[model samples]
Every structure is written in C-alpha cells, then in structure tokens.
Target: MPSQNEPAEPLAKGIIPTAKQQFHDLFVWKQRVVITNEYGETRTEWVTPEPLQNPISLFMQLSLKGWLYFLVGLAAWTADAFDFHALSIQTYKLADHFDTTKTNISTAITLTLLLRSVGAAIFGLLGDRFGRKWPMIANMLVLGLLQIATIYCATFSQFLAVRSLFGLFMGGVYGNAIAMALENCPVAARGLMSGILQQGYALGYVLAACANLGVGGETETWKTVFWIAAGISIGVGLVRVLFPESKQFRQKADVDESVHTVSAKMFLEEARLMLTREWKMSVYCIILMTWFNYYSHTSQDSYTTFMLTQKQMPNDAASRASILMKTGACVGGTIIGYLSQWVGRRRAIVVSALMSGFLIPAWILPRSERALSATGFFMQFFVQGAWGIVPIHLNELSPPAFRSVFPGVTYQLGNMISSPSAQIVNAVAESHFVTRGGERVEAYGPTMAVATAIIALGIMVTAALGPERRGSRFELARRAGDRVEVGKDVEDVVMDAEKPATVQREKMDEIEKK
Candidate 1:
C-alpha cells in the first residue's frame, strides 16, 4: 500500500481531478485498503467504489474493554447534556421564578456558553498533558456542585453568575469524553459508536424534558430538574473513579517513559508545534462547529416556547413534544451515524442537512398537538442526524498528539461564537408579532424555521466542501529501544529505528518545518 501522505493516483495520464470532480468524489462510495501494523493496530484507506463489511458485523468487532471506555464516556456526556438542557427546557419557569423576562433569563445561557471555551482550553490541555482521568473527575464534580449552586441563587444576577461558572466546567467534558470513547474503539465500529456517543446530548435533553413533564409546569419545579441533573453529574464523576486511565493514554505514557523523560516543557512544546502546523484545519473545524452549534441551538432551544406561544399548547403538551423531538434526535443520530461508516461522513451530513431543510415548513406550520409532535420528531431526526457524525469526524481531523485538546477547544470555541443563538431566537421572536386567531402572538415559529433553514444550508455547504480523514490511526506506542528527541524529525527517528512510521510523526514533521 502507498504511504498515507502520497498524493492520490491521477485519474488518467497523470492528470489531476478538477474541483468539481473532487466534490463529486465526496459522495462516491470507495473500496478501502485495511492495513494492520506490527502493534496489531489497523487503519483503512479509501481506494475505489465497492461494497464493504456489514454494519452489524462491524459493531460486533469492538473488544470488551473498548465498550467499557465508550460507555463511561457516554455517561459523562449524557450527564453534561442533562445539566444544560435542564435550564434551557425550563426557560419560562426560570423567567417566572426570577421575576424576569424569558429573554433576560436567556442571559444565563449566553454566559454559560461564552465562558465554556476557557474551560475547554484549560482542562483540555490538562487532559492532554497530565491525563484524561483527574481533570475530567474534577470537571464533573464541580459541575454537579454548580448545579446545586444554581438551585440556591435567589436573584437572577446570582443565577447568571452560577451558570457562567457552570459553562467553564461543562466546556471540559466533550473533548475528554470523546477521546476516551472513540480512541479505543475499533476503526470499523467508530462511526456507529460516534453516533451513539454524540446522542448523549440528545438523550440528556430527553431526560430533562421527562423530568420537566413529571414535575409539572409550576414556576418552582425547574429546581427539581436541576437537583436531578446534579445527582447525575456527581454520580458519573464518582463512577469514573472506579475505572483506569484510557488504554491508549497508558500505553503512550509507558513508551514515553522509556524513549524520553516526559516533562511539562516537552508536552507544551509538542502542543505549540501541533497548533503551528494545524492552525488552518483548526480554523476550519471551529467554523464548522460554530455553524453546528447554531444548527442545534436555533432549532431546539426555543422549540417548546414556539409550541407554547404560536401553537397555543399547554406546558405539559409542549414538554411532551420536546421529549419526542429529542427522542428523534437520539434515533437519527444513531442510524445516520451507522450509515456514515458506509456512505462516508460528509455525504451523510450533507444529505441529512438537505432533508432537514425541506422539513422546516412541516416542522413549524402544524398547530395541533399530534401534528406538532410528529413534525418535531422527523425534523430533529435529520437535524441531529447530521450532528451524530461530529464527534468522530472531529477526532479524525484532529492532530494525533492533541486529540483531547484539539476537538475540545475547537468545539467549545464554536460554542463561544454561537453562544447567543437562543438569545437571538428569543429576541427576534419576542420583538416580532404574528396575528393568531385575531390576536397578536410572538412569531417564534417563523423565526426558528428561517434560522434552522439557513443553518441547514450552511451545514451542507461547509460539510461538502471540507475535508475528511475517515480512518486515521490513534495508537502512539513505540517498540523498546526507540528514542525520541524534542524538536527533531520524530518520524525519521522512528523509521531509522526500524519501526513503522506513525501518523503523529508525519504531523510533527509538517508542524516543525513550518
């Protein structure tokens, strides 16, 4: 097989394909070359259009240890999601409890989102440098405590302050959770696992909606949901204490001990090197994630409000619809995530976006409970269906040495940029009014529909035009007797030592030269 860095074979007579042809190739299914190394690690390179393995058998390939890692990651992520949506789904109740408008209460959401990037940067580096375990443990435990703090805030200002602190810790979860989850998964099963893992967010939403529905629509009942979220977060943190560090992380540490003295200076230098080389890809991922954050937040955050104001539904009914909407999100994320393995990540995302865009009219035009619930379900199915591909897609694009930091930072930065999505939706919807049954009402349905439509188009264009690294390798351990020098050609060193060249070395070389 050819080196992964080699240029693609020419189409004919050494002629390179045009941009249109390259775009067309994004949708074409290709045969893959599966290569296994001396360490028993395997990677797949797309070659030509041909059938591959059955999806079911691909899922069956994961080891028992891989599943354990994936499940713990999933639990942490789910707890994080529940904590966030607990507030978002109860916007009205919170507004009423604090004696403020819904738009003002949304400021708390904004503050939480705005500061998440800081947490991602701090904890992500810690995970990359020290280990994934302790930083994550601290993040989860603190988030639980903050959730409790939210329950005690007697004033709106205090509420916003607590949520801002919440965002800091919440930002840390995605990077560490995903790195632990997918890094150990078999390459063939990654797409499926990625789909399942990303839905922890949607599942969190579902759980929050259920809690809201159970507690009724009283103004003070939002605190009950917060209490539940607190328990889940703290419980997941304690459970994490029972597990060992990620197998890949442990192996890499062991190898580093023999090859070179692992030091903070060495780790920082490597991190700086990765940033220098991957700045372009980093910018692109941030842009992609920004659109995605908007895509999910715009469509889902204000949905219950839309049903309450425009469609004239009761709180219990709106809560039920919200539950159904997120349930669709969970299902869509998993199935499309599985299909991405065969159809390719970009293709799956683009197709899902297009489908969701078409469904916007049906999503917002319905008035009856049954109609709204059905439309909401299918709409989120495609909305979050596209989201299902993100976790693994970001991981695949990340530099090998900084998987935790790279995906975490980019994703949270996107959250930072799109922090005002809900505020924007609320502001626009409240300012504008539509005549309903001879009375004026907030125009939430139109605002959300238009925003979702535009975001879906943005997602399609960005995903189609962007790059992919579907089967990149993650193993970082080296053979005994290999030595690594800081700021040297690490790839060449490993090659000279008679070991297979790693993806990390290739990335390190590119960064070092720059």
Candidate 2:
C-alpha cells in the first residue's frame, strides 16, 4: 500500500492499471495536473494533495438535511460539555457542600474520568453495531437524569457515585455525535465543521461559566446549574429524534447487510483488523489526546483559584477571565480548524502549539487583572485553536468500519490518563507561595506556566510526526456522491445520476451469481 504522503500512481497510455492505481481510484483524493516532458511531449497527470473545498462556499453547499445532522451532533456534544463543566465550575461550592477538601471533590472528577472509558467501549460498540441514533439518545437522557441526581446527592460518596455513572454515559456521546455529524458531511466541509463542532465543548464551558455567574456561585445555587444542564441534555435527546440515521451509516449498513449479518462477530473482526492495521496511529492519537486534556485542564481548572487566592482578585474578576478565555477558545478553535483545511492538520497543530508556548509568560506573569484577562484570552485561543482540528483529524484517520468506536475510545483513554492533572498541579503548587495585598497564598502561576509550555512543546512534536488524512472519504459510497456533486450545477442531479448506476451494478452482480 502506498503511504499517505506518496503521490498517486503515474498513468501510462495503453497500459493496464497497477494495483495501487486501482486502489487509489476507489479511495484517496485526486487532482488533475498537466505535464510537459523535456522533449515537449505534453501529458495529463493525476496528483493527490488532499484537495480542499472552497472555504467560503463550502458550507452553503450542505443540504438542509446535512445542516440538521450537523446541528444535532453539535447540540449533543455541547450538552455533554455543559453537563460535565456544570460540576467543574461549581467544584468550590460542592467541596463546601460536602464538607470535604477540594482534593476530595476532585476525586469525584477523577472517578468520572476513569469511568468514561467504560462508557466509550460499551456505547461505542453499540453505536457501531446497531446505529448511532438510539445509543446517542440513551446516552444523553441518562446523562441528564444523572445531572438531576447530582443535585440531590446529600453526601460526598453519593455525589461521587453519581458522577462516576455520569462519566460512563458521558463517554458515549462523543463518538456517536461526531459520527452522526461528520459522517455524511462533504470532505471539503469537514475541517471547518470539525472546528465548529469541537468548540461545542468550549461553548459548553462558556455556558457553564455564565450559569455560575447568574447563580452567584453559592452552594445552594449550584444545584440550579445542574438543573439547567439536565434540561439542555434532555433537549439534545429530543432534538436528535427528529433526524434519521446518518446517510453514510445507512449506506454502510446496506453494504454490510448484503455481504454478511451485522453481529458482534462482525464488530470483533473489524476491530481486530483495524487494530492490526492502525494500532500505531491509535497509540499516537491517545498520546496527543493526553497532552491535549492536560493542556486544557491545567490551564483552566486551577487558574480560577490562582486568580482568587494568589493574585488576590475578586470572584467576579476570576469569572470574567474564565469567560474571556473560553470565548477565545471558541473563536480560535473555529479559525484554526478552518485553516487546517489549507495548512494541513499536523502543521496547523504544531504552529498553534508553538505560538501558545510563546504566550505563556504573558498568560501567567501579568500582575494586573485586566492584563491577565487579556493574556488568558489569547493563551487559550491558541491552545484550543489547535484542538479544533481534532474531531475531523481523528475521523479522517479512523478506519471506515470502526469510525464510531475508534476515535471515542482513544479520546476517553487519553482523558483517563490525564485525570490526575489538576491534583498533580495542586500538589506541586502547594509548596510555592506568593504575597499580594498582605495575603500569602499557594502560588499556581509558575506551575501552570511551566506545565503549559512543556505540554505545548509535546503537542507540537507529536502532531508534527502524525499522519494527515485531510480529504479521506468517510464511506465507500461517498466517492460516487462526491464525484457527482463536485461538477454538477444542480444539487438534485447527483442522486439521479448515481442511483440507477448503483442499482444496475447490483442487479448485474446478482444475475451473474445466479
């Protein structure tokens, strides 16, 4: 098999096609080029640079159904983020409510992280085997109920138990959402859409911050945030019910059912093949995700306390900074995600990581509240900007048969590995102190700054060596659909052209077998 970077096989006149060319014809992205030899003999060549769609017009080309599909995934993911962060943003109040240390409350967070992989494995297999629709709905409904349950927890153990179960259900949402959202998306539109989709996480964080601000950050009011998160999650489930299974999934199902029964055995075979083929890529993705989780948690999680305690800033000031940073994350994620379409995935991630590293000083060293807020904005901007590419990047790299399970499992495993980040930072920072306004507090600035810089460098290096599958087809049928859609003047013309040919081919194959 040709490597991802290798060009497509060169065509020759009156020559039978090579095996590589035959494979390329079915899958990889291709472009036409004109070449002239030294003897002035002109020939046409096909090259593959993972062509990009017209950025401005790309989204406009998505049908109404496509937009709806994308929105459902986004809403589900956003709700997932909202429910998770609802607890995170209110950790202080919860610590007080349970009469426990912050570290104990963090144990709940860790429990949630640890159990997410269990959810991913179970729900991911269900999603791949059955369909993405109902599993996703189930995941969200359970998550909402758990959020409500969280509101009624009278003890820390009860709270931790609810959160642990919540983590399991929460893990189910990500794989299914991205699978539902981007599976039918045009390859060209994926980068831009991926950026927007990943920001749903940051957007959820922003919503949680707003909810906290609205509720005045008191222990009693924290329950209200959970209530809101529950509502959002239920609403997500209801909205998803409006759509059918994704087009790519439906197509894949049609193909699978024709060949063999869809069963656990099929899933197992596919998983085995995928792991054997792309285990290295899977390992690399998990590592990248580990660094990413650490990057986000370390930079944001403890920084609020750092502001309120070490910098002697007001709670309002700290909240304002958090909101500003998340807003930057949303905007940056979208922009960098779109840029990745042209700049290439690994390059975009590396550049963003390096840039974020350079801003660490300004991000953490600022004494003034205003300056810190501004630096925090730009800091997360670059940090999450790089993160924006992840959804599509992972999807593009995933094996077609195992798309739902592969990305989710790796991401959750990474979350599990990075679960200790906040505690680690806290333990390290306890020994350092800073004095401001006659109050001496545990210093977090240096620790966060140094940790972020190191993580950023690690991300840059990891991404630089990772593969790029920018314009890979989402499913086999997509190739025919894309070809017809690309040059057509009318949107309806594509289905009309491809459907009969597909039917005829199926008919001929069946007749031949008979």
**Model 1 spans > 4 angstroms off:** 1-22, 31-46, 49-56, 251-256, 476-514
Worst 10 residues of 1 by lDDT: 9-18
Q: For model 1, how does the per-residue alpha-carbon lDDT over 160-243 read when each residue is reduced to its tens digit?
A: 989999999999999999998887788778888899999999999999999999999999999999999999999999988988
Instruction: Estimate candidate 1's RMSD in Å.
Output: 5.3
Q: Itemize residue pairs with steric clashes in candidate 1.
A: 30-48, 31-48
Per TM-score, the best of the predicted structures is: 1
Taken over the whole model, the C-alpha lDDT of each candidate is: 0.83, 0.76
lDDT per residue, candidate 2, 1-514, as tens digits? 2223433334533313332343344333344333443333445445555556667788896788988989999999999999988877777788789897666777777888888888988898888777899999999989999999998888878898899999999998998899878876777788899999999999999898888888785678889999999999999998888778876446453333443333465446545655776687788789988998888888887877787667877766777888888999999999999888876777778889999999999998887778987998899889889989999998877765567887899889988998888777776777787776687778789889889999998887667555555666554323111212123322232222222223424432442354
Error of 2 at 476 (Å): 2.4
**TM-score quality measure for candidate 1:** 0.89
